[model samples]
Target: MTEPDDAVPLRRRTAHALDLMAFSLADVRDGLGPFLSIYLLVTHHWDQASIGFVMALGGIAGVIVQTPVGALVDKTTAKRALVIAGAVGVAVAALAMPLLPGFYTIAFLQAVTGIAGSIFSPALAAITLGIVGPRLFSRRVGRNESFRHAGTAWAAVVAGGLAYYFGPVVVFWLLAVMAALSVVATLRVPGDAIDDDVARGMDKATSGQHRGPSGFGVLLHNRRLMIFAVVVFAFHLANAAMLPLVGQKLALHNKEVGTALMSACIVAAQVVMVPVAYLVGAKTDSWGRKPIFLVGFAVLTVRAFLYPLSDNSYWLVGVQLLDGVGAGIFGALFPLVVQDVTHGTGRFNVSLGAITSAWGVGASLSNFVAGGIVVAAGYSVAFMSLGAIAALGFALYLIAMPETATGTDSGPGVFALPHRRQVQRDAVVGGELVEDLDGKV
Candidate 1:
């Protein structure tokens, strides 16, 4: 709906700012994947394999919890508040890291943070979709992804230096500060924003589409969704596991260089994400979302196979780009899928929580599994195996899933996600955002 009083929607720049601020917080913890395991090894004497297990738990929590959290987002009109609260939760959790008694303690704390992060993710994604509409959505999403990566790329230095000097706890302290800023930025989202997609979601739930779990049972009966969840679960297992290994591998060669490079790879990906997001996003929206995903996972398949093949510093940059493509494929679309599937804001948020919790589970599993794999199979075999796993998922998506974002996408998948209302807004088209408004932006 155009605000006749106002000439047009707010400049797309506003959306860019919000995504940058929000993602910065996540980069400190996640982007610094290189340091997390080392910290565990040094502080707790946990060993590589054990640290992997802890990280896997964190990933699982992120996935499982996000599912339910997505449900909550669908049920409410308070998308902005949910993101703000989640940011604060992340910050607080980061701050508490220094207090954990052991690896287990840190793992548990991470799980809590993962759960909280679930709410943060879907809400932020939903809000972005709501505000940006379809216009240049692919571009916007790409920009946001790049900014988040930029934070990680830059933070690589800080994470490595701190780990070298003061230990991992100092990095955690920095994370705390970033999280606080994330919360503050999240709150900066306008209170008056509205979208057609979100409006419809609230309308439907209030009407009577809610399932058995109050907010949790919406997808229990859907066979397709269950398969998607399982597949994603498998995919995240590798993702979560590989990250820590990256840190360990780099650290094994040169601790500081590894840490810095870990961040560097991500930063490199961030730098490239802009053009990729824009170009690929449009294609994703234009063609079937399946084909685009196929391409991304195909790249991942190569990445996994290639990573173990070389220890060369230059090649890691290439790996990050390819891996980033795989990451972007799912990262940008999954929340849109959750937004598409749920019936209400309450259910939406909860579903997100579930997804995040699943990530924690997968990551934790990967942590243990990857550490062992690295030790036995070596990084080459491990990375290759993980890529193969991603490829398997790509094949599955192609065979089973249909186009969910086509009729509804605003433009090509490329959309500019602006925080301002003068821009686009979320308008729930179908029973779900995954199927409905998850178009371009």
Candidate 2:
């Protein structure tokens, strides 16, 4: 077992992990997703249907491996290796993608990339939980989201500027460079800092329940997880294709600035996400997950409705700011809720993978469904339909999803203001601070 070097402070270690997580996002996660659609449409001259089909290949691959990847992360001690390998694999795949000829060849390549990238989320989450444990998980994850969104926003600026001058193919090269940095960041994390027991969600606070190697059947028994999974599916179905379609629309109207406009859209949302993510991270424990998450869904519902009202670039950019509000909450709370639901089952990663698989399917098909509607009807109708779908999800969540918050156990509420003479004790174990439910140092 690797022991955290006693000399290194836990705060610095947390920062290293955050850097790894952030670069991981910048390297390949959401960077390639929206850009790929634009690339196919612009370079290959592919129609909406063809673009959707190609995009779906990756989603299909993710659906197939999501569960297995989670199970592997749970079972393996080489979680860091998994993350590094995933980053390298995604980078290599993206670099090779533009060179591949024919639709099927590219589709097959994207599928492989999808499978490799699938390991990242579970591995990263498990690593964070292991390093920080649940006590600090909420706030750290918020920081992670902030970094992730910052990376995305940065990527939008770089990729947008490069693609504008050099051409869209430049994005693949950018991804390769970012991927190298992510690998370096991952290496900075001390292997010994990870607590395998806590990482697996089997810490003392949660070890009371007896858990075994429950297979996929475990999902069948958790009605709440099942319902939430469906809700996630619905949420993504409405959420995924909007940005890409908006980019395509802009390209149709003004090819020269379309790419930049798309980047602006991403920048707008992600910049907003930085603060919102931080707030969610800092406040989630105090306010409860249900209310915050409901607000996210509601914001998305409104954002979707507002999209069809205007195609003006500035108007669309303003509307996309709402994406920040919704995405920030979802980013911070999604995993928190997952941890709450699977508190001590020892299958946290696998369960999360199951829900992610559902979400992946919705995200994958969103392009197809929305693209078909756009091709047949119009952008307004498609946006309105997505809005209606988001509204349904918001309603379902409000009606069915339970409050997952169980506020601080020992301290005054996490939201409480600081008072003089309060004695703060740091919960440090093995050179790292382990916070209790109470928000002590």
TM-score of each: 0.79, 0.91
Which candidate leads the pack in TM-score?
2
Cα lDDT of model 2 by residue, 1-441, tens digit: 233353336445545655556645554655377778888887778888788777877877887898888888877888888878887888888888889847988788788778877887777787777666667778777878888888888888998998889988887888888777777777766665566656666645555465655546557878777778988888898898888888888777777766778889899999999999989998888789989988999998999889888878889889999999998888888888877777667777888788888888888888788888988998888888888989999999989989877653322111101221112323222224434446544
| Each model's total of backbone clashes | 109, 2
Give the Cα lDDT of each candidate: 0.58, 0.76
Candidate 2: what lDDT? 0.76
Give candidate 1's error at residue 278 in angstroms.
Answer: 3.0
lDDT of 1: 0.58
Regions of model 1 farther than 4 Å from truth:
1-17, 28-32, 42-44, 99-101, 132-143, 157-170, 195-216, 339-358, 409-441
**Prediction RMSDs, each to the true structure:** 5.7, 5.4
